[model samples]
Target: MKIARIEVDGARRVGVVDGDRVQPLAAHVTVEEVLAATPAERTALVDRAADGAPRPLSDMRLLAPVAPPTLRDHITFEEHLEGSLKLLGRTAPPPEWYEQPVFYFSNTNAVIGPDEPVAVPPGCERLDFELELAAVIGRPGRDLTPEQAGDHIAGYTLFNDWSARDLMAPVIPVGLGPVKGKDFANTLGPWIVTADELAPFRRDDRLALEMHAEVNGVPLPGGGDTSASMAWSFEEIVAYASRGAELRTGDVLASGTCGTGCLLEYWAQAGDAAPPPLRPGDVVTLVVEGIGSVSNRVVAGAEPVPVPKARVGHARRPRPWTST
Candidate 1:
């Protein structure tokens, strides 16, 4: 079953997308509530909602399926990371990457849904899109084992991690940020496909779904990479993510960019031959077989405001010397 969150007469409502129409659930129903239910209970709720009055999908405005309480993106694909690192003059990832999945938290407030416009961040010239998959957390877990973590997932959805490569460049060397470069926007929606629905596609812990992306009307190079190629499965990534901190329902754990999922990887591979970065009016669409697709149009961003100088310019006060 495909579950969606949509706008209905100025308010948000949860619904199930069936064919080209949507069956609206009770106004009080929410994806979070559904996630909190036991599998049998959740199935019963969807079955009952399916009998409600249906609305054409075209008439409803979809929202990000969940308003994530927290979001973390992980780099799990070796191909994508190997290509991305080339731009930074590295040919291979650090040995530590192979030991474990690494991740970064993103701004949850910036999440948008299908067909929304992605604005070019101020002072950014190399705008790009990352085609990835996100796993939604259904049950809370802390320091879970991979086998246990699998049971905590509610479902999956397509994710677009919009990026500002120009702004990202300077900070990568500083060891701590992708901050201003990435905090502006992220796209997640179309709908969430329940884990059971994707059971047939499961290969071990990773789904064997075919993934593809296109810019404007042209298909991107290496567009048919499969989700099965991920070096670390979502179960492993989620298990690592849950360490120490509790992962609550509605939290999102995104599988970072697939191989050639972003222009940056292509640029790193093609060098000066790569097509230019995204511009206003450009449309980017990503598709994952079984999960569905999400499309967004690029738009111009607001002018950046100037900043004042720092009060203390690296001055260190002298302390009385103590003999060792």
Candidate 2:
């Protein structure tokens, strides 16, 4: 079932999407409540008993499919990684990447849904978009084996890990960030397609989804094939994530940017002459085959809210170091 969060009377409600209309899922008001259902109960949202009064899907506003819990964006594509590192002058994949699927924590509260306008982060001149797949955790688990990971997933959604290349460039080699640049706004939505509903797209454990993107009505070609290009599977990522902490309900684990998914990768290929980054007033639409698409409008840039300068000391003392 295509599960969605819809706004009614300024309130959010959980609904199951059947074609162009959405049926409220039982009496639930938010996706957090819906994710609380047992895996069996979740699949049952497709049954007649769960459908509420139908509303035209076009009339409903879509929100991030899962409520904020913990958002983990993992890098699992060698092509995207290689391209990013190449722009930094590297020739091959980092050894540590093959050692384990790596990820970073992102601000879940900052997420925007379909058709919303993304205000360019203050001070950011190089705003960009990333196309990826998101997996929502269904069951709570820790120490799960890779083989046991699939059952813990509730569904999938399209994710755009928006980036501020200018904010990220300075900290790339330090291994500590890409933080402020990424924490601003990440986009997800157009509804969550339950795993069972996506059976036809599954090949073994991977889904054969083709990702596509368009900017300002022009196609941005070269998106990598999801199943073919990913070096590590979601199963592996989930298992690894569960190693030190519990994978809980509503948690979003995203497949990192696909090859040619963002301008950084484009710059790696096209070099110093690559096109200017996303500007205010640009519209970006990202689509995953089988799942729907999300379109966001870029608002005109303003002096981005300035990030405080990094300083390690809390106290002010003129040349505090006394040769201790």
Mind giving the per-residue lDDT tens digits that candidate 1 earns over 152-201?
A: 99889999999999888887778897978898999998898888889999
For candidate 2, the lDDT comes to 0.81
lDDT (Cα) of model 1: 0.89
Q: Can you give the lDDT of residue 23 in candidate 2?
A: 79
**lDDT (tens digit, per residue) of candidate 2 on 1-324:** 777877755777777888998876545445765565665775564463455578888888887777758999999888888888887778998788899988999998898889888888878888889989988887789999999998888788999999998888888678887967898788988888877778898877687888877888776756445654777788889999999899898899999988878878878788763656888789999878888889999997567655698788698666757654
lDDT of each: 0.89, 0.81
Candidate 1 steric clashes = 0
What is every candidate's alpha-carbon RMSD to the true fold? Answer: 1.9, 3.0
As a whole number from 0 to 100, the lDDT of residue 249 in candidate 1 is: 93
Runs of candidate 1 with Cα error greater than 4 angstroms are 48-51, 309-315, 318-324
